[model samples]
Every structure is written in C-alpha cells, then in structure tokens.
Target chain A: ALAAPALAQANPEVRWRFQSSFPRNLDVLFGTAERIASRVAALTDNRFRISVFPAGEIVPGLQVLDAVQAGTIEAGHTASYWYIGKEPGFAFFTCMPFGLNTRQLTAWLRHGGGNQLGDQLFADYSIQAFPAGDTGAQMGGWFRNEIRSQQDVQGLKFRISGLAGQVFQRMGAAPTLIAPADIYPALERGTIDATEFTGPHDDERLGFFRVARFYYAPGWFEPAARLHMMTNKRAYDALPDAYKAAIQVACAEADSEMTSRYDHLNPIALRRLVAAGAQLRFFPREMMQAAWTANEALMADLAGQNPRFRALWDSYRPYRNELFQWFRVSENSYDNFAFPAAAAAAR
Target chain B: ALAAPALAQANPEVRWRFQSSFPRNLDVLFGTAERIASRVAALTDNRFRISVFPAGEIVPGLQVLDAVQAGTIEAGHTASYWYIGKEPGFAFFTCMPFGLNTRQLTAWLRHGGGNQLGDQLFADYSIQAFPAGDTGAQMGGWFRNEIRSQQDVQGLKFRISGLAGQVFQRMGAAPTLIAPADIYPALERGTIDATEFTGPHDDERLGFFRVARFYYAPGWFEPAARLHMMTNKRAYDALPDAYKAAIQVACAEADSEMTSRYDHLNPIALRRLVAAGAQLRFFPREMMQAAWTANEALMADLAGQNPRFRALWDSYRPYRNELFQWFRVSENSYDNFAFPAAAAAAR
Candidate 1:
C-alpha cells in the first residue's frame, strides 16, 4: 500500500468539465459540486481537476442530467426528480412526496439496498449516480393567495417539476415545469399561481416572497430532496479506483455540508420571510387528503408500468410504512401538538 | 389562536419513554426524570407520551443517540461526546481532552453546521432534540495517557468518545472508551489503556472511561463541543409557547442526554483498577506540535477566542493570507485527478 503512492506519483493531469442544475445563487447545491471539484484537486496532488459550469453555462440548466446521459459532458450535478419525465421512477431516486426523511433515505441508499438498486436503475441510462446532497424535508410552495380549501387549487397553475406535478394535476390544477430562471417571469406574468422551490431562505433569496405571499408548509412533495453527481457511465468507468472513492467520499462530504447549510440558513430565512409579511400556511386537510389520493394512484400506475418501479416500490413503500408507523407512535404525536402553536406563537 | 379548534383537534395523544446515560442497570443516569416525557405527551394531543429511563431496559448495548434522536425511542438520547471520547473535537460539547469545539460547536450543532452536527449527533444519543436541547462547550477530561513523542501514543490505553478520538488516538495505537457498565470491568481487567466520560457521560456511565483514558486532546481540549438534547425538543417545545421557545434551545441535545445520564449513571458503580496494562499518554510532541505549529494552531486558537471565529471561519478561512491557498488551488486540482480514480476504475 505504501508503494502505491510512489507508483501513482508519476501520473499526468486529467481535467473534465462539469455542469450544475442550480445556479450559483443557491449556494449549497451549487457549492457542493464546486467543493467536490476543489477537494478532488487538493487530494490528488493536482493531478486531476474538474471545472464546474453553473446552470445554463454549458447547456440549458435543466438539461444537465441529459448531458451526462448523452455523454455530452463527463459529469454533472443534479436532482433525480428533474428527470422524472424520463421515468417516473426517477423521482424515487431523488425524493418522494411525504416519504422518508434524510437519515432514513441515506440509510436506504447507503446501508440498505438503495445504492445497488439505484445503480441498476441508472444502468440503462448509461450513468452512475451517488447521493451527494439532501435538503431534508422542504417547505411547501409559495402561492400568491391564501389557500383556504382544496377548491383554491381547482384550476391553479403551479411551477412544480417531477412526479409531484402529476399529483397536482390530479387535483385538477395544472402543473407547469419551468426552470428556476424562468420561474420568476412565469409567476410574474401569472403563468402559474404557485411554485415550490425550497424553504423560505432560498425563496427569499430568489425574491419569490416578493411575488407570492402565501408560503405553504410541510413540503410533502419533497420530504427529503437528494442531489446527485451523475457521471457518464463510460467516462466514470474509465477512472482508477481511488478517483471513484474520492468522488464517493467527496459526494458524502458535500451531502453533509449542503444539509448543514440548509439547516443553519433556513431558520433565519423563515424568520425573515415571516417578518417580511410572508404568511405561512399548512396545507388544508382537504388538500392533503386529495394529494395523498392522487399520489397513491400515481404510484399504482407507475408500479403497473415498470417492473423496476414495482421492485423499488415494494422495498421503498414498506419501509416508509414502517417509519410512518413508528413516527406516528412518537414523532407525529409530539410534533402535531407542539409545533403549530409553538412556532406561530414564537413569532 | 386559542379559539382554533382545528389546531386543538389535530393534536394527538402521545407518550414516549426515553432512556439514556445510565445502564438500564444504573437507574439514575439512565432513568432520571425521563427528559422528554411531558413534551412528547403534549405534542401528540396527549395521545402520545414518553417515559425515559436508563439504557439497560431498552438498549443496553451502547448509547442510544440515533435511536432516540431520530425519534427511535421517542427519546433515549444522551450526551454529545461520550462517543467523542472515541473521536477528537467530538468532545467539543460533551467533553474534550484539551479544549473546546464550542461555538463552531453550536454553529455546527444542527443539520447544517457540520457532519457531526444535527439530529444525528443525537441519533447516537438515541433521541431527537430538534432545537429543544443544548449544552455549552465542555472541559477536557481525565486521561490515563501521558505526554511524550507522537510515538508514545502507540500501545497506550484510552477510553475516549466520538469521531475526533478515532482520528487522533487511532493514528497511534490503543485508543478506546467503553460504556459506564463495561468501563469498570475493562479497566479492572486491564482491557483499556485510557478512557473519557463526559464531564458527565462518564459520570453517569461511571468513571472507568475517564479514569482509564485520563490524558486528553491537547489544545483542542473540547475544541469547544456544544452539548444538546437527545429528544424531540421540537416535539417537546411544540407545547404552548410558554415552555417551547422560552427554553434556551442551546444545550446541544446529545450532550444533554449524556450529561444528565452520566451524572445519573456514575454514582453507583464500584471500580477495581486493572494494573500495568494501562499507561496514560499525553498527546505526543509531533501531534500537539503539529496542531500548535501548523496553520491549525492559528485557526483553532483564533476560533477559540473569536466570537466570529473568522466571521465564523467558513468565509474567512478561504480569504486569510495564503492559509489554504495551496489546497485552494493545488489540492482541488490534484484531487479532481486522483479522486475519480476509483469511480473510473469501477466502471
């Protein structure tokens, strides 16, 4: 092992270009990729390098995953849900509405059967994926008006992406998939009635609060949103073992860092949003009920369509059910009574 | 707010019993007052309640941070650094060898701060504190190790806690820390060379880890660790605002679980010291010298004293004169080359 260092000492420089799904504006997500690129260069003694391109620089922001899939780029950073159009099952790889929280998701992916399952799923796409970042559960979307009942969503247009769009569509609302850059204009032009980005902090930073006054609670659509570093299968396959581990370790590091940034900043951002007159509202029971029904039906349809989805769902849903049962016995009971009153009163 | 029947109706009935610090055997440390009992009960519309007790009854194996902190037990969580006794800087809140991981400690206290931060910190503690618990930085503890060259750490006995311990003590030989119940036997049996208990994790688990692992991390002391809750503090504080936000919200949940339990656990056990096998070693010169003499010294020392710690060091570290300049450039460059070696090879 010691001689390994001496043997590797004489390697030439390798450089690759990478793109990000997020703009530099959303620091952590974008920063994670930047950090990995940074750490890689540092750890390799300057022998390997990655130059990152933020959203929209090399290709359209939303096209990063495709770029990696098409081998247009060697690697890229993105969220799986972004490509749900490619396959609804992809949503499970990124996040699930009202699904597992961060730790549970990580456990499933790392220690549980998730990683192997995920790689198998991505095999057809000719890409390899790693769990790089998580946003925990997110805040619900931002809306221009207070949603008093399910009727409020009857014909609303929302800038939501991935499988969640199907859920909204089921509620009789139209789901519009728009890139982050196009969101502000669309919402401003009344093209969409609502949009869910992240928590108050990112929303405020993007000035969504300026246009939308009603901020919903419990980002049920993304109970735990994960980001991935998708690499072209061929390109990725070409690297030495150490580089792969570096990517894995670096991705884990970034995953940890990104969540930390969100945890630290979200509180302040929520406070700021509230102070700025952003009215926070929990989804109405009727809405939650309706969404749940739609979500269940969508999943059923998905399972019927793909064997992979069926297999993954068989493993995934049961775990979620178990977690829910446990949390219901403890987490929910406590949170339901405590947070609403406490959080509201705190302000 | 009081007239909102919907809110009251939504509250559930919950009671959860949390255990910690003490062995199921050592009742006081583990059983004392079931910290989150009232809060868990309150959160669940009174349908849920938790009665916390010592570790033996539920999980006598090791600390229950993740089980409870992740809401596994509703609450069995405990002190932050009892594990740190294993890792260095891990003792920042729970306890440290030489110093504190304090403020950076708390900043990293939640999901966003650092890897060790957040609910997972308590996940090991066995409960979810969520903003409900915290402990300030802690004192470095008694160690069996003596000071000498870095090599002296080789074969020395230690019973430290957390990740830092692994990084530091692991570099050489003989870094170990066991639970309170096991510590006495190990020490009496000469199984451990050194140990660290929280000023409290040990007190409750009882002095063996501390008694045997006497020597502490130099300069780092705690490196400023921040202790916190090992429960659903969010759940607990979710009660009426009166108790929720009024709580300090600073105790770094895991350490809170650790401290109270250590205090509770440490009292009853009798220890028969093992002879000869244990030789206390202070961190050797090269290690301490490396920390003090390298940029780490300037950074750690400045962080220790500064309120901002380099405007919280996140920003400043990158900006400081040539401090990380090489890694800033060369490190990332090299790592990008070398880091992907494994991923590429696997493909």
Candidate 2:
C-alpha cells in the first residue's frame, strides 16, 4: 500500500501511427486497431501509445501493407491475402480457398509453425506481421441473382479480393478487387453484380440486402479470414522488451475479440437481414466443385511460379490436412451433432 | 532515448501466491497458469509477481474455488464446473451437456453478457472470475469396452467431473468426480470402467490409451470445456489500474493460447495414440440420443430445484440456440465442405 507512481522514468514515451485497411464503418475490423492501441496504452501506463487511421485517412484502403513497409505508418491492420500480388505466399497467412476454420487457423499460427512461415515472408518486406484478428467464415457474397451452377458463374462480374479473385476468374467469373467503401456502390450500380465483403454483421452495415437480395453461404474462398498487424521491422525491433510484450498481448486479445464480436453480432444481424428481404441460398454443388477445381489449379500455378508460395504451401497444406482429419474426429463430430441439436431443441 | 530505469522508483513491488487445480504434468492446463504469470511479470516490469502452486500443494485439486474465496490463495486457476455443489449454475460457465462449442462459448462470454451472469454468481463467494483458457471439444472418453447403446452404459462406473456426472447418472452410469491426478489410477485399477478427461493431448499424457483402448468421440456433456482464473475480489480490487489491465491482457492471451495448443497438439497426439493400437469409435446415435434425453431431464430438474440454474440457463440456452442457427449457415457450410475435402484429398 506504500506504492507511489515512479513517474515512468524508466518507461520512454513512444508513439506509433497505425492504419487500417478497413473503413471506419466496419467496427469489428477497424475497431480492432483501436482496441489494440487502447490495450497497449493501458498496459504501458500511457507511456506507449498508438494513433489509428482509417482507410483513405492516410493511404488508400488496399495500400496498408505498402505504407507499413515504407514506414509511412509504423503499423497497419489488414488482411494478408490482399498482398498476394506482392507474393502469393501471403495468402496462407490470411486464409486460402478451402482452408482452416477460425480455431484451426489460430492453432496453426500459434503452434503449427505458421508464424515462422509468415514471418519468413514478412521479413523480406521489412515488416513483421502479427495475427491480430479474424472474421471467422465469411458469407460467400450477396448476389443480385442466385448462383445455381457453373453456368451461372460464367461471365459474372464479382467484386472479390485476394487470390479468390484469381480462382473466380478461372471459373469464368470476371472478378475485380474493390475496396470496402467501394463495394456497396459497385453492387448498387450493377457495376459488379455481386460482392463479398465479410459476413452478415458488416454486410448488414453496408446495407447490402437493399442492393443484392440473393445472399450466399460458405465463403469457400475465405473460410476463416485473419487480419494482421503489420509492423515496420526497424520500428518493431527497437522497442524495449516490455513494449514488445504489451503489443503481443494486445494483438492476441484483439485476435480473440474479433471473432467473439462476430459470433455474438452476426446471428442478430443475419436475422435482421433476412427480415429485410435478404433471401438466403446455398451455392450449388456443381458451382462449388467448379470453384474448388479452379482454386486447386490457380494455387498450383502460384506455387510453380513463386518459390515462397511453394514454401508456405508446403508448411500449410500438410498441417491443414492433418488438422482436418483430427477436427473431423472430435471437433467436427461435436459440432455436427450439437449445432443441429440445439437448433432443433429451440424449434 | 531519454528514459532511465524509473521502474523501481515509481512502481510498488507486489507478490501473490496462485494455485492450480491441475498438476504440472498437464502442461497445457497448468502451463497456462505459468504463461499468465510470465506475461504479467513482463508487462509490469517484474514489479508484480505471482508464484504458482500445483494442486495438492496448498489445497486439494477440487478446493481451488474455496481457497480463492477464503483468501487462502490470492488467485487460483481452475474450471468453474468443479464447484457445482455450491451452485448448479456454475456448470453453464464451464460447459454443460449439449452446450456451446469452443468459439460459441467464448462468444457468449465476451459479448452475450455471459461474464456478467458469471460474475453475479462468483460475487457471492467474494471472488472474480476471468475466462483464461479452453480445451476445444473433448473426446467422449477412454472406455475399456465400447458403449454401443443405452444398455452398454447401465451400471458402468465412469470417472467424469462436473454436472456431467449428474447427466450420466440419469443415463444409468455411475459417475464419480475424480481429480486429474487420480483418474489414471482409477482407470488402471478397474475402479472406473471409463474416464473422460480432456481431449487427446492431456489424455495422451495421462497414458489413458494404455489401459483403455476403446476411445470415444464427441464429448456431448462438454462440447467445449473452459478454464478460469478466480481471484479474491478483495485482493483484485486493491491492485493498481495498470496491474488490473496486465492481468486482463495476460488472461486473454491464455484464453486464445489454450485452444491453439489443443488444436495443434491434438492432431499429432491422436495419430500417435491410434498408431499405438488405440481404437477410435464414434458414439452410436442410439447412445447419443439417449444421453440427450437424460441430459434434458437432469437440466429441467435442476432448473426446477435451483433459481440460479434457471437464471443462467435462461440466458445461455437462447444465445446458444441463436448462435447455432447462425453457425449452421456459413460456418457449418464451410467446415462441412472444407474438412471432408481436405481429408479425402489426403487419402
């Protein structure tokens, strides 16, 4: 009880600017940046702080990685797959077509050597990335019309990002990368007939139901999309041990909190969206099969063209394979039984 | 860099003794306590430290809540369900028969006012609880003989903790609450016919496979078992604001880390166990359905007998039902497709 404030004599005041690739409208995505900054401030007793900027406040939405790498911002929060143009291997750090669920992805990152592979790629860019958040499984997208089969996908104009765009293109859909702020307008104007931008909570915020009535399930392209806090390596390495620990702890909290928020909010949001006339539908087997074929081919091409992609794929695919088998054992068995059972009980 | 080491001058040194309900052998469980302490020390610049004692060091394994409540230990790490004798509602905080999965439970805790409900329960005991860790879905248990139906479970002695014992008792199994340390001895000596400890990682460590070859899937009674850090409220309220923030951050890390540990370790451990001649079997639908019926009756009876149980159940059941409905949409679709695809492709 005799403790007095040491007045932070040993704690150097430090400040960093953080940019989010998401617009401020998406609270779960953009809010995670604020949460991380706030936790760091609290843990460090205000000696260390971070200021957050939404997309376009500094660099445009998709330029977060470039800004962080160039030290224009000390850190950036963005999805890893958005930088597949920089290196296809970057996709593994985020999510891949037919990849891990939320828990499986985090497990891989924390224990299955995922961070090492991701770090190896990030180091080349003068960046160190931490898995800061996840959006669980994204709804496939909102379509103006139902996608029934492979034929329906042909020549479809889709606003999609990451390597999923490449796979859609392979399946004969014309895919374009649109920033989050731009997706609603593109869909409304019919410039893009469909758009996939996170799940029900965010989609509801964007009022996608008003513009696109046909909502699809299972974003196969992004089963569990993870976001990263990309820090400028020089800036990160210079931090004291305690500051480093603060960032690690804060980022991990954001990592857990994001999905928790989505899980809590999405159900309520989905119900509202449905009430507002968003007709829910599942992608047909033929289309999913075609998309799967396309994804496989596109990934193979990426691996053949990019050595780093191959290296990450080598680490990621086998772990995914083995984890899937185990999940199908206990985790899957439980969910397959329990979710339906709960739903039925409520009925 | 004008900072001098002002830590000793400004910070008050504080220390606390912590106890774990788990033994040191279960690293993922007890190791979480150590991780929390380490993270706190690093964040607080070694000014605040907690020394951890394993179960039986201070009090027996199941006496952790009592120790924290009585201030015998400043803090304790244990599961909530172990103290169901005090309140059947505590089982909802840990897990329940046909309860939420790992993500669903955490989601409820974080966003669905689960923490408030739990805190209301703990406040009576002069304790504060924070969810610190999770072991995804547990495998049903290690059984000497396969449980093919309701008939197979009649008079079977099972070493299971929690209200699950009550549920099993309703299903005609004689269930005993045994500490983690005593479970192996009970199983080995034929004192218990079956035991459901955690999933593969802890079960494998305990050598349950050596004595019980018939391992079961889908731990229905505990789809996801969560652990908590229970701190004496008197001790917690006296901490510095920064110290409170440090513990919150560290516990969140452990919350995320525990599932990651299980997800990463379970797959490998499962493979090893199966290769060592362990038989993996799914609980027959007949048995699962019968167990569900038994669980429903037991829960209803508890709700009738205890107002607190009814209060917690009132909050939990609806959130779970709604979450399950939402999960069956995108999450189920993705996992149902991706997991099986990955497994088949591996073959």
Candidate that scores best on DockQ: 2
lDDT of 1 by residue, B207-321 (tens): 4443454424222434333433455545564544322321221122222333323222222221211131323233444665443333344446546765433343444232122
Q: Model 2, range B116-173, lDDT digits (tens) per residue?
A: 9999999999998899999988999999998878799999999998888988898888
lDDT for each residue of candidate 2 in A150-203, tens digit (9 for 90 to 100): 899999999987889989999888999876777888888999999998899999
- Candidate 2 chain A minimal-lDDT segment of 10 residues: A1-10
**Residue A317 C-alpha lDDT in model 1:** 74
The segments of candidate 2 whose C-alpha lies over 4 angstroms from its true place after superposition are A1-9, B1-10
Candidate 1 total steric clashes = 184
C-alpha TM-score for every candidate: 0.56, 0.97
Q: Looking at model 2, give its docking quality level.
A: medium
lDDT of 2 at B252: 92
Interface RMSD of candidate number 2: 2.9
Give the top-scoring candidate (lDDT).
Answer: 2
